[model samples]
Target: MVFSKKRSFTMLAALLMVSLLLSACSGSKTDSSTAAETDKASDSKTLTIMAETSSHADAFKSIIPDFEEKYGVKVNVVEMPYDQYQQHLKLKFISDQAEFDLAYVPIGWVPEFQLADYITPIATEQAKLDELELDDFPGIDNAYFGADKQLYFLPYMNETHGILYRTDLFEDAAEKKAFQDKYGYELQPPQTMQQYKDIAEFFTRPDENLYGVTLMGENSILSGFGFYNRLFNYGGDLYDSNYKQQFNNEAGLNALNDFKELFQYASPAAKQYGWSDASSEFLQGRSAMAEMATTVAQMAQDPNQSTIVGKVGFTAIPANDANTSDIKRFYLPYGFVMTKNSDNQEAAFQWLEFATSQEMMEKAAPVGNIPARTSALTGKLASEYSFYKPHADIMNSFRLETLPLIPEGSTITGEILPNAVVKYMFGERSAEDALKEAATEFDELMKSRGY
Candidate 1:
């Protein structure tokens, strides 16, 4: 499942938001009605889950039969593209036509869903909580547990944003020697912003129709995600601790300028790229590297969808080592949540428990679904799945955060800041002016929402 431009975590014009799941082989566009082939067993109850198209759909297929057999529930995952899914769900709720018992929600949407009273907390006994093995998820309490001590969301899939590069190119003798001779250092994955640009410039070759990196510049939200990720990389934030606008300053300016500079080494078509487009450019061997989700990085090893299998490597995105936060990872927790209108909350919670169980996650990992469980992400499974170890290490050791889980979070995400960055990149406005204007818009939005 390549990313969409619509939702933030769709790992979306993904900055400031996201909702993506496994990579290109996911057949993420499959019809909901056919997602699961339910048995025609007598006296079986049916539960419908509103979800985005994902390889998780494929992973879930393998577990549905077992869950159905044990629970006597026939599950139907009603799927849609991430770009349209958010508005679709909002309309569903507004019209009271939200018939699904459960939904796969982008964590960024949690606040809006909460403020709108659209979902119910997953109320359960201590025994059930213990059975869920909640401790297996590192960020669960901060992300989904409410002040009232009720669980509000269940994360089935989660990810970190990082760099994906061509290992064969990095490891090539001729290339490494040339790079070292030219740059005066070992040719390796970048640890700082300068190294990233340096590596990109070295690999860029227009005559060969290749470039240093593939980037997302089209689709405001998608581009916004790209810009924001850069902003995050430089110890910049959309807002400061007091919730004041702060991305117009030094670090933000650096993030914006650095984002524009990368375009110089990307394909001219880079200006029109989104996550999926950039992903394809990297996967098809058109570029040396790409900044994408850990989930997307897994596809680099899939023989069916990648040309660089056994020749790809993933790592944390580049940051200025001297000036950055310990949180090198971008948080994209796309998972399932129980809907308030559901008449089958208990059964839905049961599904959430069974689906996120350690057993099921380990089963799902091989199919490209990154498990949220601690055990599933380490030891044996981590060894088998190349993407898991880096992601697991980041999750366990680092502090991660997403966009403001506020009712107004959606309005701030997707385009406002990214569009501004693009205007500056196009020479239509000065960087200072563009950021100042965007920051003004951000502050106005917060005020209008009574934040």
Candidate 2:
């Protein structure tokens, strides 16, 4: 769908932040020591960078020839799956024998990497710092900083969530009129939770071979967090300010109940669905709507992948209150960092800067990944790329929120929260009972870790 007024503000804020950062970069000069070091780069130095196996990996690989040609250095690019990457990185760092100079890491893993001393903190050298202004990459800078506020890693890409709907199903004037008449409101995309539910219910006709919604509901850590997104937006959070888990409270109960209620209108196989299953359902036209990442927007519109190519529309996650003018959304950053135990610190820093550079992001944009740099959001790369517009539009529409900045966040959300949600969703226990138990377990876990 077309971007709304709310999205315009988001775009402005992102652009303003980028402008401020670029101005700072222009004013700062590299220190002479760094300039001398950069000048002395010998052809013998070989830089190795570890990257995740994603759609963007090839785009990253595509730039190595240019990098090597310009710097007169040989580069080795290694790709690993997400699950094994962490273990391999830990072993390499603990033994102080890492083969790679740099590696890609999720922002959520920054704290763990920092505590394990797996990443080297960026040098304080004026020239090196000047090369890529921290201000330009505020999200990454914030993620890299420790509790005491020191920079450790750099961000390469930023990701967010949005809604995907079928325009063709609701395109007929008579059908639209009928929907509005039945629902007592226009049949447009929902702006609030009530509206979201209303729309889902309206589209649901299980016996007629159509379902209202499809979700990533397979029993996993992701399912729990996905449930939390809805719970928190409805004014409930997993924990209170005092570190007590509060999902058993009124807000949490209502949130869980609302989700459980929605399942009646979903596909029978939804319980088995993950990202692949949900996307396939939406693309194949078995479902009317899906809550998904920006990365999936184009896939839903592809003729080869979908039966409804020209009929897809987009919007941010529905709000809980229709009248609320501002909708807050979450932004997730994916990027790279240097381990503290690296044998070649200088090479790591150079490679880190190279991977996160605006120039490199611009080169990588054509391969279906969004760049973290603000400058990469518009112009030739955006216009030339097929899926850029929908993702950019969604990003521009919502205020970005991040997960709570706590050390035990992974364990608490990954292991503890999912068990509690499943019990509640399946009616094994009341929301109150499940959440109360989850809170106690989570608090104990955190306490044992000295949180």
Candidate 3:
């Protein structure tokens, strides 16, 4: 069924806002009232930006003065908590007097927004697109494009899930010797799901207050993503071309069972862990490895925040046997959407181009926004960090077809499928039963939506 966009956005936003800093704008000398005094009075426009109160929001605020000064415009940034950001925007879009010109959109919400005519194509202006260096943002543009093949959003944060492990733990003399004696292979970052499991099992030592992996086992977004990362590698898909559920098949069963096995090697609180707890486990040196968003790479190396300094390593998630060539992983893109109902589309597009440019991306990286551009990954600062290049590589190699592109995508990803994972993980149902129930629920949902 069509998910209540208001409610679904609230839930998804809450989960994502945890790592964000809820701060207001710190720069910008130009206020909305002074728009006409800055430059050509007739060309000046007051643009209001509605974005989630996050690190990216903070970065956007920091750069406002630059844009306002250069373009002779005023930007009023209205930051909302994650839970209210989407609902607030939706309400504004449907109103007779919609106030926002630009919005920070999560990729999963793109289809619903486009279908409701809440957002307009960012690429409709070809000259603007070329000037923004849109081609530099590899593996992200298509995710924001509408069904008509028009780009509707610009990439802000480009994230992919991967293995973050302790380099020291993997290279330890004693641990390496023991691992080789048992598994008959060099102890290193995993290259296959089977090897990943074996390493997790080998490293587990609850008595020493250490766990092999830090799994996001909560019933929210992260856990669901964990399942998808494995599900894709194992050749399981959420739905087939006909929009029929396919996750109840053999590949699905194997993926779910393998995911369950991981919990046994994870932290004791893994069932309650979301993205933060999982990453914190690795940062605190309580977990030897973690499968999480690449955004945490810089955080995991900050000496003030992490104990694992100079010791973290990253790699793409391993593939299952049959699909070695089709490595599937999550690509959660955060981007900017220009509202179709706005009065100042041109000004908003200018702000969007500046906010998502290579310069802004590089500046935003230290604050938590993963760079969506290819140049940022190979740039000086990114090159200094061992983790950035590999993460960039993984993002480039992601299977574009893995995530569901339907209008009900958010509901399925952020709610329905995740509920089934909780049931199966808690042993309340078998893999077969859990997926079967999920398939039935999805089928009914699609039918009710007139799919």
Per-prediction RMSD in angstroms? 10.8, 16.2, 9.9
Ranking by TM-score: 1, 3, 2
Give the TM-scores of the predictions, in the order they appear: 0.88, 0.81, 0.86
Q: Which lDDT tens digits does candidate 1 get at residues 1-451?
A: 6545555344434532322333343344345444432321222367778877777666766788889898988788778887878888888888986777888877888877776788888666788778788888867874564556577787777778777888899999999999999999989988887898899999999899789988888846667766776777766787766679868888778888888888998999999887778888898999988877876677777888888887878877766663444644457887777789887777888888888998888887678688888777874677667777777755654557765676666667676787787888888889999999998999888788676
Question: Distance (Å) between predicted and true CA of 48, model 3?
Answer: 2.4
CA lDDT of 215 in candidate 3?
91
**Model 2 residue pairs with clashes:** 1-314, 7-397, 31-127, 118-339, 119-339, 119-340, 120-339, 120-340, 192-319, 193-319
lDDT of each: 0.77, 0.70, 0.77
Model 3 residue runs over 4 Å out of place are 1-44, 140-147
Superposition-based RMSD of candidate 2 using all C-alpha atoms, in angstroms = 16.2
Q: Which of the numbered candidates is closest to the native, going by highest lDDT?
A: 3
- Could you tell me which 10 consecutive residues in candidate 1 have the lowest summed lDDT? 35-44
Q: By TM-score, how accurate is candidate 1?
A: 0.88
lDDT of 3 by residue, 203-274 (tens): 899999899999988887677887787788767888877888878888888778888888999987999998
Give each model's clash number.
15, 10, 1
Name the regions of candidate 1 deviating beyond 4 angstroms: 1-44, 145-149, 322-328, 396-398
